[model samples]
Target: MSSQKASRKAKKKQGGKQRAQRATSNVFSMFDQSQIQEFKEAFTMIDANRDGFVDLDDLKDTYASLGTDPEETILQAFKVLDPDNKGVLHKDYLADMMQTQADRFSRDEVLQMFNISPIDAAGNLDYKSLCYIVTHGQEEEQA
Candidate 1:
């Protein structure tokens, strides 16, 4: 029984190493040589402790640098993306994160901007004001 447990532990560690190795890709296929360096730079920024993988601790470290905690959604997203829970978050999910997280962030910004719009500067969200902001704002911007 003890040997079986040790075997399982060894297999898990080996699987982790295999996953790490399988993660490598031809950077040129996704980005040009110059862009590859930019990614490495960004990865280094996120990879606190100078480790190759950005784990949950790195996120906390990054937040410490910014003097804030990671938002609930961001924490959840990170947990979901890092399925192995090996405390090492593989970088491939970073690309997917950019797409998913970025969209939600931008949508939030739009909602905030709309909320503050002078379309209802009087602080009342009437139908007329909504229409004016929806149509008039674009016309004014184009002018």
Candidate 2:
């Protein structure tokens, strides 16, 4: 009876391993060879101790090697973006930002202008409104 139980456990373990392999293969098959290699290299960088797994220690070591504290970096960047130091970006401030060299309308401005019109039942702009906006409607003259 013990021998039979051991055989059954072995079969179950083998079946689980096979299922895991199949799942891994299906996921990897979505990417080409170059993409797979790139992902492997990225994973290797994140798995700093080379133990084939990423933990908090590995992440700390990786970030330490790069000499960057992500939280401080993000906070500094936000400070630069938020000149008034309001801790949040207002719509007008976003609209005035020089995102591109061209004179095209800012996305925030477009959305604000679109708010004047009635939205559809789904809270989406209809095809006609989309066309009017894309075609540079009377908003251009007003600007």
Structural similarity to truth (TM-score) of each candidate: 0.31, 0.33
lDDT of 1 by residue, 47-106 (tens): 988978898788778877887745543445545655655433323344335447745445
Error of 1 at 33 (Å): 1.3
For residue 28, what is the lDDT in candidate 2?
Answer: 74
Q: How many pairs of residues collide in model 2?
A: 0
lDDT string for model 2 (2-111, tens) is 99999999999999999998877877778999999999999999998899999867876776789976445545654676666645444344345534435656676657
In the order shown, the candidates' Cα RMSDs to the true structure are: 18.9, 19.1
Q: Candidate 2 vs. truth: CA RMSD?
A: 19.1
Best by lDDT: 2
Local error of candidate 1 at residue 124 (angstroms): 35
